[model samples]
Target chain A: MPKEVAIIGVGYAGFRALTPEVSYKELMYEAAVKAYEDAGVDPRRDIESFVTVAEDFTEGTSIFDEYVPDQLGAVLKPVHTISGEGLHGFIAAYLQVLTGAMDIVAVEAHSKASNILTPDEIMAFAMDPVYNRPLRANPHFIAGLEMNRYLCETGTTREQCALVVAKNKHNALYNPLAAYGASIAVEDVLESEMVSYPLSRLDMSPRADGAIVMVLAARERAEELSDIPIWIRGVGWCNDSFSLENRDWTNAIYAARAAEMAYRMAGIRTPWQELDFAEIDDTFSYKELQHMEALRLCRPGEAGLLVEDGATEIGGEFPVNPSGGSLGMGHLLDASGLARLLEVVLQLRGEAGQHQLSDVETGLAFGWRGLPTTSGAAVILSN
Target chain B: MALLEKVDKNIEARAWQGEIPIQSRYTCGLAGEKFFREIMENGRFAGTHCAECEYTYVPPTIYCERCFAKLDEWVEVGPEGTVQSFTVLLVAPDGTPLEEPDILALIQLDGADSVLVHRLGKVGLDELAIGMRVKAVFKPKKEREGSILDIVHFVPVNA
Candidate 1:
């Protein structure tokens, strides 16, 4: 039998599109203090190990894991870097507890995107040197091509994509830390300057600075630690084909596989009605639509209609990304996944005040990574 | 061959020795790793032609990791090929907008199974197409060597 793991504490520090006033270390410390308080445990005492999700390219610093210790107060402790996003880090931490390796482990992911001077150069460098890099194409051009292909395959309109932007940004208006929340309209998104053909300025998530942390504990430690423990019922992560040219641009195969693995592990046969609420990453307006189809929240191409029907609103059948997702919250790379997981934990604990939904027990969180890798992680959190 | 000769910087008077950074990275597979030595030496471009898989690559890579077979036969990629894709970059990674556009293109070196990314020479976005054929124009013969920059660019074939 596998040992169970539960989140005993969670903390967040930023949703700022640009954080210029404070040093990056101070930004992380702010969240660390909150996480330690919520976990009701000290890093130097109760926490057994630390795991951080970070990448060298995002921060423009190599071997970035070295800088994590000073900020989080994890001095002289076992620390590991997952080199991916938050949920990937979350899975690594979850397995640590499940394998009986340690009692209490903390996972954190953060981003300081606003500080970076050249975001596209970093992404372009990620391409295959021989074939892709020579094109000098902005990464968003791929999003444009893929979006065009998606519209062709799914018969969805640019209007639907615009609606996703409008709805998510509107949802963020209620969130205090939401960076991109505004009274945007479908026409506004459609009329936005075309960054890549068919993909407007509103299509992509704005880069932002933020930190999110979660403390996971073994079942016994969790039960003793807190009255409200959100047990991680299932954790799954997977990757699809790497070559973007060969891939079917319309579908998120990796997300579907990830969702299936998590659903099976959690014994969830029908996710649509069974899962209470979800926090899916909407890095781009169309991504949410594609991922919703991939997660089987609605059938492929039905997400546009689902959004229009008001079925995914806060009070509807499935309230998605009540904290506003990457659209409102801003794109913090590895931190975005953890933010979704944090929302699930908060909603399950009845701590999500304004965006709170009724009778929420089970919550799902999804994350999609770049490199056109079709990489994603799904976690089921329940009280 | 002598990059420093063109710059005409008087190194004798400088307090610190001049430095021209040439740091670049390469992706190495079985074939690519073995091929790098050949590329770094002579100015010739070569690739493996596997009997079993019939796979050919320019700037020869080694054993086919895909087919799991040792490939020894070499094939030369021609000086001309067709463009698979092209882009005009207007912004740098740090969100700095460029003053002028740079054309980057993927060229399928003739006789190779795959394409190599390189700079395109003297072309406008409006004049280019996905299949427009082009040929490699090398640096002056005195400068030709194993480096990727041995060939200045793949200029339009008809141009």
Candidate 2:
């Protein structure tokens, strides 16, 4: 049996399209201090181990792992970089906490996307250098292709996807931390600048700089530290091949397998029935729907209707992305996972005031590291 | 006044030119024995077939990622897939800069288990369709410098 892990405290330094005023280290330090205070523990003595989620290329810094410890208050503690998301980083941290390796783990993830003056140059680097690079294509091309396939397979339409941009951007209005809140209509989204076919500029998540940090401890350790402990009931992650030649663009095999493992372990036979709410990885509008189907929150190809029917609305049956998700929250890449995890804790604790669902006890969080966009993680949480 | 003119001319020169280095590493893997041998020979695309599972892999593999075991057979895949998903791009990666717009799409190859990523040509965003039939246009055998780009791009074949 996987050992139980609990979130003793969660902290967020609000996301932004560009936090030009603060240095990357400063952005992380602000969140780290809040996390320590929220957990009511000192990082110097309480944090037993640290796990950081980051990617080398995204940061434009090769040894990103080396530079994080100082800002996170781990001068010489055991730290491991998962090179992905806070959930994936926390997955490893949970193991450390449960295996009696460590009592407290500080998990952190952040992005400095705005620092890259040429966003296109950064995106172009994500392509497969040999075969993919020569094509001279924007990363949005992949989003467009996936969107087209998602529509064709699900019997959904472009207008429906436009609604996702409208709904989420509108949903951001209530979220103080959200960076892209605007009162926009479906027609407005459809009319926006086209980045790729079946996708518009508004359909995409903005590249932004932000940070999220959460402190987790063993179940017993969590109870000792805080009155409210959001137990991590299940954690599972899987990776598909990196090369585009191998991936199935229509669906996420990694998500399907990871969700199954986490759900089964959490004693959740039917995610749609058992899961109270989910903060899915919606780097693009379609991913939320794709991950919904993969999570089995809805039957295959049924997510489009789920969105169209208002089932995923903030007040709906299965409220999704009440924090406005990546579509509303900035896509801080690796930090995106922890952002979802943070929102889950907020909702379960009745702290998410504007987008709170009705008495949510069982919540699910998922993360996908967008490297040729193949890796994903699913964690089941309950208070 | 003289210094201002010199500085203004320098700013224009700085604005127009500079080469920035962009590097990335891709440690992609190949599966299966025949596929492994093809990589050792350093040329071409290979596929794996499973009669029991009835799935074929385009870039070849030692075992089925589905069933997880060793497989022996190999075959040639694409130079084609009917266009499954496509997008036209206004920019290319650092290594291969393009002055003209380019089209890239996922091709569900004729006899492969999954779609392969490739470039599409002679196509505009307006002309591209979901189910368009296209053929792989290979970089000449002499120019076939061993990569997924061996086939430069997929073009609309005369159906």
Candidate 3:
């Protein structure tokens, strides 16, 4: 029998535009302290492994993982880093506990996006040098291209995409941790400065400084540690073609594959009916609609209509991103996945104070590595 | 007793400014070598074809992505193609407006399965539309350096 994994604790620090007073180390340390306390585990004594998610280019440091263990209090222990998104780190920790090699594991992901002054340049550096890089446009141009194709193929209007921005931003107004919270109308989003055609300024999530730490343990260890442990029923991740030239711009094939693997493991036959809510990637407003269809929460071309009908609102039949999502809370880069998982955990535990939804026992969280990469992860959580 | 104290507002936050100096040289692999050579020597676009899967890859690759078979067949594709998707950028990567807004398009070159992303010249945003035919405009042969930029930009086929 496989040992089940549960998230016993979650902690985070800083969801603001800037955190000039604290270094990335201090941010991680703050989150670590909260997580250790919430899990009632001493990192020095109980944590058997540590995993962090970060990219060297984003951190502006080579071998960024070397600086992570110290703040996490996992120094000289089994600590490693995943140069991918936060959910990838979570999946790594989940596998560790499943192997019975570790009883309790700490997973950390953070973003010091405020520190990078030239984020667009850094993003361009990740593009294919001989081909895409020479174009010299902001990386969001890719999103613009994808968004236009998505709308054209699906018959989704720009107005429907604007609804997502309006809804998510409004939803953020109730979330204390949200930095971009607002009660704006769709017209406001439509009128925002156009970054790339079909993608406006409001369509993009702003960069923020934040760190998230999650504590995962085997079932028996979890029951002993926390009264309300959010069980990680299933987890999956996938990467499609690395080249945008060949990728399907109309659909999030990566999210679909990842969701399929996770759903099969969780025995979820009907995602819309089985899962109560989701915290999906909304780095771009149209992405929320696209991911919904990709995750099978709705049929192709139905997500935009569902959002327009208020079906995805907090009080509606299916609530997505009730914690305000990346658009509302701000994009945390590698930590974005963990941020979604954190919200799902909070909602499942009935601890999502003001942003709480009723009768939620099971939830889903999705994460994408954003533009220039067709990589994504999905995690299913149940209380 | 108070456990927290606030930092003085008058005190300035200190930060260090530095950059990692790194440069790289990439070998245009077997596939890239063939693709770029054709562009540099022949002034035309070429793609690799997999007979088993009947798939043509633009920006050619050595092996078929779908069938994993070695793609040894080369076919000339797209001096002309259709615009599959496009975007007009109001600002550059450095956060400044160009003298004129730039039009970028993903051109699905003729006889290829994939699209090439490049700038669209000689067309305004209002005039550019999906399915609009466009043709690659290469730089002067002497100025060509076997790079994607060797083709300066793609312009409307009629233009």
Chain A TM-score for each of the predictions: 0.97, 0.96, 0.99
Candidate maximizing DockQ: 3
Task: List, residue by residue over B30-133, the lDDT tens digit for candidate 1.
Answer: 65555544444544457888778776756555566447687789877767888766655454445556566656555778887656666688787678666789
**Clashing residue pairs in candidate 2, if any?**
A136-B92, B31-B61, B31-B62, B32-B61, B32-B62, B79-B136
Query: What C-alpha lDDT values do all the predictions have?
Result: 0.77, 0.77, 0.90
Least accurate 10 contiguous residues by lDDT in model 2 chain B: B1-10
Q: Candidate 1: what lDDT? A: 0.77
lDDT of 3 by residue, B1-159 (tens): 111442335256577887888899877788888888888888899899999988899999999988899878999999999999998888788766666777888999999988999999998768988899999999888888888889899999999
Candidate 1 CAPRI grade: incorrect
Better of 2 and 3 by TM-score: 3
Task: Give all candidate RMSDs, comma-separated.
Answer: 9.6, 6.5, 1.6
Query: For residues A43-91, could you state the per-residue lDDT of candidate 1 as single tens digits?
Result: 8899999999988877666788998987787889999888765899999
Candidate 3 residue A32 C-alpha distance from true site, Å: 0.5
Over the stretch A1-383, how does candidate 3's per-residue lDDT look in tens digits? 13399999888898998887778888898888888888999999999999999999989999988989989989989999999889999999999998899999999999999889778888888899888887788888898899988998999999999898888988889988888899888899899999888899999988889999999999999999999988988889999897879888778999999999999989899999999999999999999999999999999999999998999999989999998899999999989989999999989988888989999988999999987889999999999
Q: Which stretches of candidate 1 lie over 4 Å from their true place?
A: A1-3, A245-248, B1-22, B27-159
Q: State the lDDT of candidate 2 residue by residue for A203-222, as single tens digits.
A: 78886788888898887778
- Alpha-carbon deviation at B66 in model 1, angstroms: 8.6
